[model samples]
Target: MTLSEKILARASGRDQVRPGEIVTCKVDLAMMHDSGGPRRVAPYLERLGAKIWDPSKVVIASDHFVPPPDVDSAEILALTRRFAREHEIESFYDMQGICHVVLQEHAHVLPGMFAVGGDSHSPSGGAVGAFMVGIGATEMAGVLVTGEIWVRVPESWLIEWHGQLGEGLAAKDIMLFLCAKLGMSNDYKVMQYAGSAVTALSMMERLVLCNMSAELGAKTGIIAPDAWTLAALREGGHEVGDDALRWQSDAGARYERHLEFDAGALAPQVAAPHSPANSAPVAEHGGVRIDQAYIGACTGAKLSDLHMAASVLKGRKVAKGVRLLIAPASTLTTREAAADGTLATLVEAGAIMLPSGCGACAGYGAGVLADGDVCIASTARNFKGRMGSPGALVYLASPYTVAASAVRGTIGDPRDLLAMKAAA
Candidate 1:
């Protein structure tokens, strides 16, 4: 059985589970954010006179509307705190970071666990081998009332990437290439990543691959736990179990589809406005000017991601007319970046740093683009009007590309900047 099948089987008290089978599984963890947490679930729980099935098994974060830009947003945050305090949920992370990044920072997720999150990017948990997926507000409330939820076992699709990634490219580039090649029609299937390139990636990069699985329309994305995965959890202060590495797909595991790619041959990619499926090589979209270059969101604003941006922006400045905004994924990410001088490099490049939250990624809080604005961003999604005015055009790319674009004031390749810096 695949890792997902094995975990689901254990959670459901079964010997095995097959693709297309429906089963009720006990949840090992449930995660929620301010936007979708207490405010969304409190009313249903009150109506049913129910309490959280297991507060200890839950983790909540106030990521969205973090700085509370208005009264309505502030009230939402207040309700989130009240709900956690009233329920005695000690695992609540308030304004600490995006829920997904916060959980990884604190090691709340582990291999072989069955987890669910209230946000669409929940599959980010799968980077560490958890069988995690996203659910709606009603479905999340149901999980809160009862720790068991039903799921349809999905067939796995293996996307094996080999060779080595070229400089100035990253996991975000790999995922953008996939979104265009595979198109986002993979419903009821799991997008499983494997091979040398994926295994060589750091946990932060692996998180990017799984976090964007939602863009592929897959049920979730996951990677089997390896020494790298276990080590990351351990470094994050988790007392990883001895058998944590055992959570992997069996040899010759069945997969509905197996696709292979040569990572070394791939170039940096960028997705055009309205769809990640409009991706192409960076050269294809070159010379298109941008008003803003944003590096933020759970998918793009991690510490490592910030380092990538800093590398390109080191001795450069943002284009005279372009606004460069950097929003670290978490407060912890900000502190680490600052300590290492990455934050200074970015600021010296004329980048404006924003609070660490899900800012401007969902058209919430600050950094929203104005009408007819054209921006290059490092966030995962680029749906029309999702980041601001429907008239604004948002292009999605990696931190390297976004930073390079900021320096050029246009959608240019990061390799240009990297190569020039190397020569310098």
Candidate 2:
């Protein structure tokens, strides 16, 4: 069986399972944010008068709509707080970070666990070798009450990214390249990344691949547990032990498809407005002017991601007309970046640091584009009205490309800037 199949089989108390088989699995954890947590599921839980099956297994964060800008937003946060207290949810992370980042930062999700989140990027947990997926508010309410949910086993796709990634490239570029090659309509499919380039990536970089799997329309994404995965888990205070390595895909694991790519030949990629599938080489989009350059969201503003942007922006200034807004993935990221001077580099280069939250990525918190604005962001999606007015254009790129483009005030390749910096 594949790693995903093995996880499902274990979670469901089955010896083994096949693709398309429906199985009822006990959820190891359920995560939610202010936008989709208590406010949306509370009424339903009340209607049924059901208590959470296990409060300790639940994690909540106030990310979207945090630091409320309006009365309604404030009330939602209030309700989120009230619900957390009422249920004695000890894992609630309010205004500290996005739901996905907060959960993993606290090591709430572990390898071989079957987890579900209210946010689509829940698959980010798979970076740690967990089988995690997103469910809607209604379904999440059920998980909260019963601690169990049904899932149809999904076919696995093995994407092997071999060789070495070029300078200024990252896991985001690899994902955008895949988004174009594999259009975002993959239902009931799991994207499991592997090979030299993928395994060589930092855990945060690996998380980017899994986090963006949702953009491919995949059910979830995963990577086999390795020394790096175990080390990261241990650093986060999880003693998964050597036994967690058993969660890997078997030698003869069954996968519906196995695709391979040469990381050396890959270029920085950018996705055009309204669709991540519109991705192409950064060189193809050169000279497309942008009004704003944003680095935020769980996918893009992690500590490593901030360092990526700072590497490009150091000693350089953002274009005069461009607004560079950065909201670190979490407050913890902000502190880490600040300690290492990455935050200073960004602010010195004209970045305006917004509070750590979903921010413009969710079209909430701050930095939402105005009508007619053109922006390049490090967030996962560029769908219409996702970051602001429908009339605004949002291009998606990596932190390297976004920071380089911010300096250029147009879509430009980060490699060019890096090369120049090296020569200087």
Q: Write the per-residue lDDT of candidate 1 for residues 1-424, one digit (tens) a residue.
A: 8888988899999999999999999999999999988999999999999989999999999999989999999999999999999998999999999999999888889999999999999999999999899998899999999998999999999999999899999999999999999999989889989999999899989999999999999999999888888888988899997699899899978999999999999999999998999999999999999999999999999998999999999999999999999899999999999899999999999999999899999999699999999999999999999999999999999999999999999999999789989999
* TM-score per candidate: 0.99, 0.99
lDDT of 1: 0.94
Q: Cα RMSD to native, each candidate?
A: 0.7, 0.8
Flag regions of model 2 displaced more than 4 Å. Answer: none
Q: Over all chains combined, what TM-score does candidate 1 have?
A: 0.99
Candidate 2 positional error at 184, Å: 0.3
